[model samples]
Target: MFFGCEGVCLSFGGRRILDKVNCSAEPGRINGLVGPNGAGKTSLFEVMSGRYTPEQGSVVLDGEDLTRLPFHNRARAGLARTFQSPVVPSTLTVGEAFRAARKSHRPYLSKHDAEWAARLVHLEVSWETPAASLGTFDRRKLLLACLVMRRPRVLLMDEPASGLINAEIDELDLIMRRLVDEYAMAVILIEHRLELLAAVADDCVVLDLGRVIATGDPLTVFDDPAVREAYFETPDA
Candidate 1:
């Protein structure tokens, strides 16, 4: 397994969220996390990235325990994640962000490596364009490119399709597919858009009210009666 979470649980205040949510991500596979709003998908992503420690269970990466590692350590240990909201620095250019990530990790790498990474993510823009000037979709792509340059073994993405137009969503999907195919990275994508998720994910894990409701092929998960009911049925009085 590239990344594994077993028996993970988290709580805030008096309520429990993400109860024993077990998941495994393997290289070259995109695992989709799908659920109704407030189902704890983002919380699980946070836990995987070490933003929040789980109250119980373990996070293992490549057969080693990573439950207690800090965010940067986890990142250096071949883990990368994209935020639900893009956090690219406004002062830097898109190219600079990618270059900085490589420099931070492997300061001695030649300039060719940095250029290669930007090209890998389809970032052919001028190096001098300030990041603040990028459109929403380009900013998101830049963040992805920065993460990919690190060559992480696993990636955690939160709602990658949100705020993107249909055409841009399609473009982003193609980029993600290329990453998995070319880099063999394990990807965990948290998405509310079912159609896009179904198109990309090989398997889907459905969470409802912070628990695993179902796990299987995307078609099965989407067609499941429980999934539909949880997402659409009227609540019982």
Candidate 2:
């Protein structure tokens, strides 16, 4: 595993949100994290991304324990994450947003780096365009470009495909594949769209009420009786 959490446990207001949860992402692979609405998937992402501290467990990236590292520190250590919502700064122009991301930390990235990332994600907007004016799909592209510009080893994306149409999702699928197959970054994606996950994810981890229910290749994990019963079961069932 290039990046993973081991024995992670988390709670909020005395309610267990994650219990002994274990998940991992491999280099050059897409790992899908799936679960019911309250399955603690987002909370686990918080732990892995350092937004929340776990009572027990370790977050490891390339053999280094990052359990206690702050979010920015983890980002500096080759970890980056996108939110469930596309959060481009509304006040900034497309160029300004990219510039801010490039200059976010020391060893400032050059304009060429920003350009490369934008092109890689197929963001065709003009530099002068206001980030707030971008449509949902374009906003998603801009945010993804900002993160990839840093060349992080681990990328954690939360519901990136939300609000995207099928055609846009197809484009995103191509981009994700290139990121893994060409750039060799480890990607952990939290998504409800099983069709997209089935197409892109190399592995799947199913969580139910904060506990891992299954982990394996997507087909096998999705087919597991427990997983089907827990995740695929209809509300009326």
Candidate 3:
């Protein structure tokens, strides 16, 4: 497995958030994590990327133990995650953000390598446009581009399709699928966009109140009445 979490558990204040969660992903596959609000999907990603250390659990990457590593160390170890709300530099252009991250992460990249990362994320900006001027969709796209520049073996994305228009969402979906196919990278997606999730993910893991409620193919899990009752039903019911 490229990435796996063993017996992971996390708590905030007096409340236990993730409860002995176990998840694994290998190359050439996308894993989807779906749940209602406060289900701990973002927390799990935090643990996996070494942002928030779990109270009890182990994070393994490509068979190496990564439990105690700091976030930057984890990034150097080939783990990268994109945020639900990405912050872009006000003075930098889209291409500049990619260049800066590449320089920071790899540092030894030649001009050609930098250009490759830019192309990978579909950023075609000139070196002059400030990143602050880009629209919300492009800002998110630039963030993804930065993640790609990190050259991570396993990539985690949180709600990447949220708030995007139909055309932009379709474009993002195509980029993700293409990345997986062409690079053989492993992806873990936490997205509320069920339609896009079903289209991209090979398997799905559903969480409820911080526990695994179901795990299976996307269609099977989505169709299950238990999931519908726990997550999809109107609260008025």
Candidate 4:
């Protein structure tokens, strides 16, 4: 099965944020979405996640159309996403956050689900700890646990490795690979951190200025001259 966008287009105030971008994530595969700042990677994610309807194109999952579905419906349709920043409710406790995520897909959170999610993300805090009380790295892990608790068909992760130590990043990378293989789901990861993306992604898609500039093997795509030019200042305009 696969999930992807075809000919997606989005603009704000007459300025294009995404322009006819196309990419796919196959089951049990990690598709890395990378670009320099203002590259519209996140905007492309918004179009795929149904946060913003695209001006043109479709969001497809296993051959079904999801372009018009709202965020909740998309989640119900087996879509889950994590933001560039953690979005766990500050008032909710560690366990509550996990429970809240599961509540959308199930009436009650099972012990197995809780343990699986907590362990998957290497969650360490007590169930009683307020989510806000955790540090940035731990907080990100907690939010990741919340999303993974649901076992969505398509996972959209935005900059999940930000603010993590080398060890934690390594753990995150391993966990992501395990999750994809275990669940057989399509995962699109938008990350600025090249090392992490290179380590986790099975394939790579490069987006620059709202357009897909390159797509293929992770190492090859990153090494493309266009990609280098986007990151490093070139003498020629």
TM-score of 4: 0.94
> Across residues 93-211, which tens digit of lDDT does each residue of candidate 4 receive?
88777777667554566868878888887888798998888988888888777777777888999998888889888988888998898878789999888899889899999988999
Ranking of predictions according to TM-score: 2, 3, 1, 4
Model 3 superposed RMSD (Cα):
1.4
What's the C-alpha lDDT at position 54 in model 4?
95
Q: Which candidate tops TM-score?
A: 2
Candidate 3's clash total is 0
lDDT of 1 by residue, 1-237 (tens): 569799999999979998999988899999999889899999998899999999998999999999999988998899999989987888897667766766776444556776776777777678789988987887887888777766789989899888999988888888889889988999999998888888899998999999999999999888889998987567889
Against the true structure, candidate 1 has what lDDT? 0.86
Error of 4 at 82 (Å): 0.3
TM-score of each: 0.94, 0.98, 0.95, 0.94
Measured by C-alpha RMSD in angstroms, how accurate is candidate 1? 1.8
lDDT tens digits, residues 56-76, model 3?
989999889999999899888
User: For each candidate, what is the lDDT?
Assistant: 0.86, 0.94, 0.85, 0.85
Error in Å for residue 104 of model 2: 0.7
lDDT of 3: 0.85
Model 1 scores worst on lDDT over the 10 consecutive residues at: 105-114
Once superposed on the true structure, which residue ranges of model 4 sit more than 4 Å away at CA?
105-107, 232-237
| Total backbone collisions for each predicted model | 0, 0, 0, 0
RMSD of each predicted structure: 1.8, 0.9, 1.4, 1.8
Candidate number of the best lDDT: 2
